[model samples]
Target chain A: MEVDRTDGRTPNQLRPLACSRRILHRAHGSASWSQGDTKVLVAVYGPKAGTKKNENPEKACIEVVWKPKTGQIGKPEREFEMILKRTLQSICVLTVNPNTTTSVIVQVVHDDGALLPCAINAACAALVDAGIPMKHLAVAIFCCLAESGYVILDPTKLEEQKMKAFVYLVFPNSILSVLPEVSSTMKGEPMEHGIITSVTHGAMSENDYFLCLERGRAASAKLSDFLRRSLQSKVPGDSSKAG
Target chain B: MLMEAKPSTSPATFVDKIVVPGDVVLDLSTFTNETIKLGGGLRQDRDAISVMKAGKLKFSKPNKYWVESSQRRYVPCMEETVLGIVVDCKADNFLVDIKGPAIAFLPVLAFEGGTRRNIPKFEVGALVYVRVVKANPGMNPELSCTDAYGKAGEFGLLKDGYMFETSTGLSRMLLSSPTCPLLEELGKQLSFEIAVGLNGRVWVNADSPSTVVVVSNAIMNSESLSGVQQKIMVEKLLQRIK
Candidate 1:
C-alpha cells in the first residue's frame, strides 16, 4: 500500500531550503526563508522603549504581526501571530531588556506548504541577526500523516490538502559545547529533543501524532544544522575570508 | 561538525574566533588562579563562560574578553561615546536619540563649566557628541557632554557637518586603533573632520560636500571588505572622484 507523491519523491524527502539574512536595510534585523515554493520574510524591530498596556513593565514583551500574502490579517493570521510570539518569547532572554517591546513582523511572500514552519525559521534567523539576547536558536519543521499510517517529512500544498492530518513542530537546535556532560534533558529525552512549540490540524490517533513527532524531530536536526551553517558562513568577517 | 568545533577548554584559543549563543567559550575549571573580566554578549553561568550573541570573540591583554558583533541597532552601555541628535528640550534635560532602545537624557548642566544663567542654548535636532554616564535597565540612559574629568574635551555641539548612519560594527571599525585602511587611505589625500559614534552614527565635515559624500560612502561600503580590499576600494573611489 504505497502512496505516490506527485513530485515523485520518497515519503521522507523535503523540498530544497533557501535562506538569506539582512535583506531589509531599514529593519533592525530581517531574513527571507523559502522551503520549495513557500516563502516567508520576517523583520525584527526594537526592544524599544516600553511595553504595551497590561504587560508587565518589569519584563520585556514580545509582539508579533503577521501579514498574509494578500488582503488584511484575519483569524488565522492572528493565531499565527500569537503562536510565533510565544515561541519567540520562550527562546529570548527577556529580562536583559526589561520595560521594552520587541516586535517580530512576518510577511508571507508565498504559500506552498509548511508556510508556518518556514516563517518560524525565518523569524529565528532574523532574531539572531538583530543581536537580540537569546538563550538558543529554534528550528521548525512540518510533517503530515497519510491514510496508510505513513508519515511524510515535508508535504507540498496539494499533498497537504489530501493528508488526513499535519503538524508543525519547533525544537531547539542541538549544541556542540566545550563543557562535558552539560546536556540537559527533559524526563528521559535530551533537552534539544524537547518540543518548543507544536500545532496540529484535523484529528489523528495518538500513535499517529507520536509518529509525526518522531519524524519531525528527526527532520529538525538536519534543518537546524543547515540553519547553523548558513548563519556561520555569512558572519561579517568570516564571509570575506571565505570569498 | 568540524566547522562548529570550538576549542576544547582554553579561553585563549577561542579569542578572535567566531562564537554563537550557547557556546561555552571559557571553562573556569582551568582558570581557578585567574580573574577574567566579562564584557557585553558574554555571561558567566556557573563555571562556564557562555556567549549571549553570535559574534567574534575578542580578548584584551591581562584579563578582558568580550563578543564583537556587527548590527544595525545599538544597545546602550556605560561610558560609550556616541553622537546624538536633540529630539526635545526640557527644563533640566535634552531628549536625544542615540539610535538606542529609548531616548537618552542629556542633562542641561552636562556641558563644560556650565550654570543656570549660562546654559547653552541648543535648537531642536542639533547633533552633540556625548558620553553615556548611566545605562541602567528599565530606565532611559543618561548622557553627558563632558568627559569624566568634567572637561568638554571633544564632546560638544557638532556644527556644520553632514551626518549619516552606518552599522555599529562599521563605526567600531573606524574608531579602532592604528586606524582602519579605508579611513587611512581617505585621509592621505582628503582633509576632513570625522566623528564616529558607537551608536552607528557618523558625522563628516570636509572643505566641500562632494568630499563628504565620497568619504561617507567609502566608509559605509568598507564594512564587509577586508583590509586589503578596503585599500583597493578606496584607491578606486579616489580615482573616480578625481
Candidate 2:
C-alpha cells in the first residue's frame, strides 16, 4: 500500500539543509551540517605528517570514523564509514598530501533521514575548510523504491524502514567537461557520467536505477549551490579555485 | 645569528600573491651568486624555490619568505606567545593544549622566580599566557611564563575574561602593525582589556559584561572584512550599544 510521506514534501524534493564551516576551534577543518531533522558535524584533521607502515607514500590516505550520538558505533555505522571513505576517495586529490593521513570524524547529532548523505556533505565541507585539494566535491542522496515500484528521493529513516529498497547515489558537483551530453546508455548523460560512487540496497531494476539517478542529479544541483555559496564566504577572493 | 641576505637573481613577483604547492616562487638560476633565505611554506630545490603549502606568499624585506594562511592548528615557533589551557599536570610539567599537533609541556619551575616550595597551581582548565621556549619537530613543545631575564612580562595566568576563539590568521592580524583598525575604533568608544593568543584564543575583559560581548562580536565579524569594512562594523556595533 502506498502512503503519503509525513512531511508532505514531494517524492522528488530533498529536505532543507543548512551548513556552517570552521566551527571547531582546535580541528584543522570543521563543519556542522543539517538536513531537516538529521544533523552531522564533521571535523577533518591532518595532511600533517602521520601515516601507518602499510599506507602508500605517494598519496594521502583518507580515514572516516563515524560516531553515533548516544552509543558505541554498531555495524551500520561501520558500513557507513567504509561507504563515505570510498565516496570521498574518488574526489579528493590525495596526491597533494603524500605520506600523510587525513582523518575525518563524523559525529551524528540527530538522524531522522538520509544520515549517510548528510555525513558525506559535512565531510566534504570540513575537507574544504581543512584545505585539502580535491578534483571535485561529491554530494550523496538516498532514494527509496516503494512497493508499487515508485522511487522516492531523500526518504526519511522511518520511510526507509517501510520501503522495499533504497539506493545511495553520489554525484560530483560538476560533470567533467570531457563528457558532455552524448546520447548513450553506458556513458553519456551528464548526470549519469558524473557519478563517483553508487550503492544499492535491495533489488533495483535498470529503469528504476536510472530514474533514481535522474532525481538525484536534479536534487544535487541545489546541494552544490548551497555548498559553493558557503565556501565562497569561508575563503574569499576565489570561488573557482578548489585547491 | 644569520648575516644579511644576498641579492636575488631577479625580483620575485609572488609577494602578497596566493600560491599553491609546487608553484615555483623563485628561479635560483637567476640569483645563483646570492644567498636567499627560505622560511616556512617554501622549499629550495635545485634551481627553483617552490611553495610547499597553499597560502599568500609573504616576503619580509631584505630576504625572508614564507606563506601565510588562516589555520586552526598551531605549529609551534620559538618565542611566540600563546594562550593555552591546562589539560594535565605532572610533578615537573603541566600538559597544555596550545592547539598544536601535540600538547605542550610547561615546566612548573619555569615560572617567574620559581622554586620547588612555591609551585603555582593551575587547576585543569585554567588559562595561561606563555611563551614557546622549545619547538623541535618530533618533540613536545616547551612553554614558560618568564622572559629572557626571567620576568613574567605579561606572560602569566589570564583571569576574569570572556575567552573565545578565532582563526590563527585573525589573531595574528589583531596583534599586527600600528594597530588593527577594529581595535583602534573600539578603543575610542569604550575601554577593554584583551590578550590575544597566536593559537587563536582571545580573552576580552571590559568594565561591563556588555562591552566585552560587543568587542568580541565585532572582532569575530571583522575576520573577513577589510580595514574600512572593519571600521564600519565597529561603528555599527558601538552604535547598537549606545
Considering only chain A, what is the TM-score of each predicted structure?
0.93, 0.88
Instruction: Compose the digit string of candidate 1's lDDT tens values, residues A1-243.
Output: 476999887877778887888888799998888888898999999869899999989989999999899998899889888889899999888889999998999999999988888999999988988999988889999989877778997788998888888888999887656555643344667667888999998888999999888888888888877777767764432311110
Model 2, A1-243: lDDT tens digits are 354788887788778777887777678888888888889999999756656677776677888899999988899999999999998887776655556678999999999888998899889878767766665577778888988888888888888888887888888764212111342123535533477878888987899989988888888887776665666453543332211
**Highest TM-score scorer:** 1
**Model 1 chain B, poorest ten-residue lDDT window?**
B2-11
Interface RMSD of 2: 8.5
Which candidate leads the pack in DockQ?
A: 1
lDDT of each: 0.86, 0.78
Clashing pairs in 2: B9-B30, B9-B31
Docking class of 1: medium
lDDT per residue for candidate 2 within B76-190, as digits (tens), equals: 7898989999999899999999977668999999998899999999999999999999987556789999998999899989888899888878999999998999999999989
